[model samples]
Target: MIEFWISAGLLCLIAMGFLLLPSLRRNRARAEEDRTAVNVALYEERVQALEEQHQAGVLDEPGLQTAQDEAARELLADTDGDAGRQRVRGRVVPMLAAVCVPVLGLLLYAKFGAIGAVEQARTAAEAPGTIEQITARLERAVRERPESSQGWYFLGRTLIAEGRAADAAKAFQRAAETGGRAPAVLGLWAQALYFAGDKQWSPQLDALTDEALAADPSEASTLGLLGIHAFDERRYADAIGFWEKLLAIMPAGEPSRQGIERSIAMAKAQMDQRSNAQDAPTPAKGIRLRVALADALQQQVRPNDAVFVFARAVDGPPMPLAVKRLRVADLPAEVSLSDTDAMMPELTLSAFEKVELVARISRAGDAQHGEWIGREQGAPRAEQALREVVIDALDKGASGNER
Candidate 1:
């Protein structure tokens, strides 16, 4: 937040500085143009007067010569003097302003802002989640209890993990029916619907959320759904209200709190975008996936090492996403997954429809899991899907579905 202000203030100062220098330079140029025109006219008039005097026999050759020399010398002195003075003035102000603007911006940011903390928060936001460990546990849990709705929920989450939006939506639907409509179920359903880009199903999502909200007003998931719906519909005030309610319910440093804060920022940004239609600015639309090793789990590898990161078309053959390989020792304890990573080709919120991410710590070592960081459950849906595939494979092998 503080960084935003500092950046905003710096940008304003830059714009102001640009405006000031150009206007001043224009004024100075106009002044020089005016002076040059006046000086030329004076010289022409003096020469005409000299010609008239000579024609009227009012002056001798020497007098005319002396008058011409005086006029030319005067013109040279005046023009040079004015040019030097304007040059000195013009060069000085812009240079002084250039130095002062950024300095002033720094001082203002230091005195009245939260730039450092905001940057730290932003950095935290960029860190990758420990999804693999969670996915592993969720996978284990669902295997242990195949009939549990918790397992279904976990499976839906894994479908989401694999970027299988449509499948995740179906799984979430099942989870909701089995659990009698949990807030998490409703939230995930709504998110899946939203990501699927089908407006026709939104009314159902809205109804589900209404019921969920009635059951628990402080439910962060439902509140998030409301906020998202409001944001999507351009109801900024409503969205802000919902997000604020969510923030009030959540303690600082919680995931819900951070998510709500991001929503608020995005909501306000959308508001600003609407207000500035003439500007035609576009927000960043990109996604990044980073893979890293846990420090506590690392036996011999350095924490700062780089790791391989890749992505593929969710529905196609495992084509690698464009990225460079870095050693596992180059990255911090947490890796950042973002669009800027070279591995992300055509990165956008909608680009990933279904993808399998594999991160190997080493050829022989166990790869860190994805899909379990914030999600407490393993992917039950994935396990079920795997089972179905296995059965299908067996049936194909047997040439029929008959047991």
Candidate 2:
């Protein structure tokens, strides 16, 4: 900045030099004009003296005429152009200008020029190699001119890039205020405030974002922030709903399209999982398995015995994620355990990373305790081909207790 001012002062001096130097130095044209004026004055004085001498009888008419002719010749020799024309005068104006021009320039700059802005611009041009320096300049600019909403907005963005959400929120707020609560500005301000509060939602932020969306329903940032917040709070349906709205408004080939799509997919999976937990058995969103009694166990199994086909988390509470019931007579049948078939309101196939399938034949028809069971364990996924669960093992206590 100092270097900038130094250069600026030097340039001003150089310009003033150009403007004032010619006035101080004598030029050929002015010298000729001066010489012509001097010669004309001398010629008039000599001609008057010769006429006085002739009138006093000290010189004849011819002498007076000869002296007058000599004076005219001298005048002609000294002058270049018409002798009647007047020469421009007064060094006072140029001298005054030379003396007062720099002062006047300084006064004008003090009144209307942006000294700080000029210095900042000059310094940036001279040394803009670091982000910190650039950011500092931006900060100073916005601070100096609070009404510069665009400048403030960019400063806020830079602050966010610097991971200063708290500071960025302040800048964004200023920008929104200065920028007349513009939709994008307000939405971004809300986002910055949200992060500054450690991702906690506030009524103020909610109001801000709502207002922004009201102004522009297709505002992507507000929708995206809302969706992300919902997803983080496990409100998958709300998350999906918000993201779906954003998706509808997003342009084709949007740079953020993939991220939003992934979020939407995950939210949908969570929503489907929750929905399945509270619904009835349906394979539309579940896994399918074929339960069959082994040929050797066929003779031991009773046709009227209850057969329970279910899926449970591999390492979770001892509750079925989904379950189906049938009779032993229905052996070699395909059964489905899905979100709709969840045994509890909080358990579903999609919620668990892994689950085991079991086909149990219970003589007493108790779900918790079974006589003989066939088991298959792996990741639970909706598959067209049925996974086989054959009842082949003897009940550890069923036959023993019967005996």
Candidate 3:
């Protein structure tokens, strides 16, 4: 607030100074103009006096000649009076001082009055990824650059992440005040409000998502969350529609695609089961096996070095279902696989039957084989199922197929 007042005062001072500038300049020019005109008139009078003396025969030839020479010398002396023009140009100093004073004062005022260094130092004291760190940095960034709506949006998100719901809402409101609503900001702000327990703001989520969809309907996060919301409301058809639309937009094998795939599977299963109860023939439901390596290692589902799961028919393209990466902290004596399903978003195993299955943890950002299963009938029953695949494949000499 103090900074605002100081800036306002400085701006007013600058405005007033500029307003006074042209008047002062015109007055100075007028003074120079009057003096120049007076000097020219005086020179003319002196020449007229000399001419009259010569005409009146006030002196002989030598005297007239001497008088004429004196007049010429006086004319030369008056030439020095033209220095007034230099004085007019010298007005530049005042003009420059007029400009410099306000600007310099602004700089000095900012240096001394604004809390820049203090904010920067405070921001630096915070560590990345920590709530405190994010908060301090966010505050400092907003303070330093209040005009940046993007920065405000980021600060709002940080505030939300830190659980400062009221502050986050205010920050988001300020970001919107900039009259530039980025889709990411709108979506995030809606999420923040949702987390803050304001169901009224829920519609904003749809509005924002719709706006984003207008640009790129395939945006995964937007579609995924909206689909989830629809499914939560028991709107299975709506959920399926959203998921399918998202599926069409997403790349094959993308995590989002997997999620959409699972939702689709679940929705279809529900629909088919409903139809079956109504005396309809049960349609076949395909299986999609997705194995995700989750462990204390690399953190859970980090897509680090954890194994990826893939299942394909003995003679089909290897369909990649899911990638699970672990972190160094996540490594433990045992790795557990949870939430494995044919129709789940993270993995899809039902896509193939009578398949060759492989589970491998690789650091190379892609799935590889650490365990191999031949003719596996169903999803792994336990963590041992994952580990035993290696044993069975080795015992059967199926290891000869690939490393």
Q: Which predicted model would earn the best TM-score?
A: 2
Q: Give the TM-score comparing model 3 with the true structure, all chains together.
A: 0.36
Better of 1 and 3 by TM-score: 3
Local accuracy of candidate 2 as per-residue lDDT tens digits, 99-145: 68778877898899888777656655776666676689888787677
Count clashing residue pairs per candidate.
32, 2, 22
**Each model's Cα RMSD:** 31.5, 16.1, 17.9
Task: Return the lDDT, model 3, position 350.
Answer: 40
Give the Å error, residue 339, model 3: 32
Instruction: Give the local distance difference test score of model 3.
Output: 0.59
Question: How much lDDT does candidate 2 score?
Answer: 0.80
**Tens digit of lDDT per residue, candidate 1, span 89-146?**
8888878877787778779878998755565456546544677655555555555555
TM-score of each: 0.33, 0.50, 0.36
For candidate 2, which ten residues in a row score worst on lDDT?
81-90
